[model samples]
Target: MLRYQWEDAVRFWNSKKGEDSERVGISSRQKQKFTHTAGSRSFASVAEAEEVKSGQKVGRLQLFEITHRKKDGSPMTSEAGEIMEKLKDKKAEYEATASTDSSVNLENIDNRIITEVLGPERYSRVRFQGSGVTLTQYFGSGSQQYMPSGSQAKAEVQRLRDQMAQMQANTVE
Candidate 1:
């Protein structure tokens, strides 16, 4: 029965191999035939041609065209011109307001807001001086200390215990 099953499997594999050989497969060159035409041209030149055909501008020219022209591609009307002037004035006003708000001196900011944001302990330590504050003043000047690990830590603990024991003994005497 096992020999019959092995023979059947071998026949199935031979049939599949024969079917694959009979079928036609596309070559890599045929698959990329269309891409070869476009790829022959520089990408930028092709893109520029497409943009010009579509009535679109490139980069800063596009931005200028958009701002200057009406949405329907007609020249700006008198009413539209007035609206654009109003928008420009509003924009200038908004920028002036923003500049004034941002230019406020740090010293002019209320202590209450600073205290609330920083919390009491941090606020006390970080009280801003006009000359400029150093990070060391706010968070200690000490560098991070290395801690012993494993056997070293155990030895250190034992040494500390021995010193404490000696001190206790002396106090008792």
Candidate 2:
């Protein structure tokens, strides 16, 4: 896996090495540090809290700190800094979506109920809207997908209940 990654990176680097090509100098240390802490939700949350405490309403996402160095341990070029900034912006956008969109609060719903009734596959498709506490089930394929409601949703829920009952009855033996 590492070999494949190394080869792919080398291939990418080589492709960018033309007369007019400006290289982005990213050091291994920076890469290691970024990889180590990039996905840490707790770290991001703490940083965000600290920013809020400092009276900043909205703060830049500190996804990764780019060290001003190149692949050869030289100073970073302007092109590299620009690239890193772009990367940071992209990461912030993704984190923003992940933190906001459909972060579930199964406070009133139990995991056992979900597993026994709806099954694991349907769990991801279920969105619990907080306003009216509506359970919107996205059904069918990508562009053709639609939310199930009214009689369709009721019938599906009933079917799941029946399945759960049958499973419980069998378990009693």
State which candidate has the highest lDDT.
1
The sequence of per-residue lDDT tens digits that candidate 2 reaches over residues 1-173 is: 69999898777667746312433344434453223222334444644564677766322222223133444644355544554566455555435533554332222223223233324433343322111221343333442223333554465466569879999999997
> Backbone clashes per model, in order?
0, 1
Tens digits of lDDT, candidate 1, 46-128: 44665688877443223223344555665355543443354455445435533655432232122322333333333233333
Off by over 4 Å in 2: 1-75, 103-173
- Model 1 is weakest, by summed lDDT over 10 consecutive residues, at 104-113
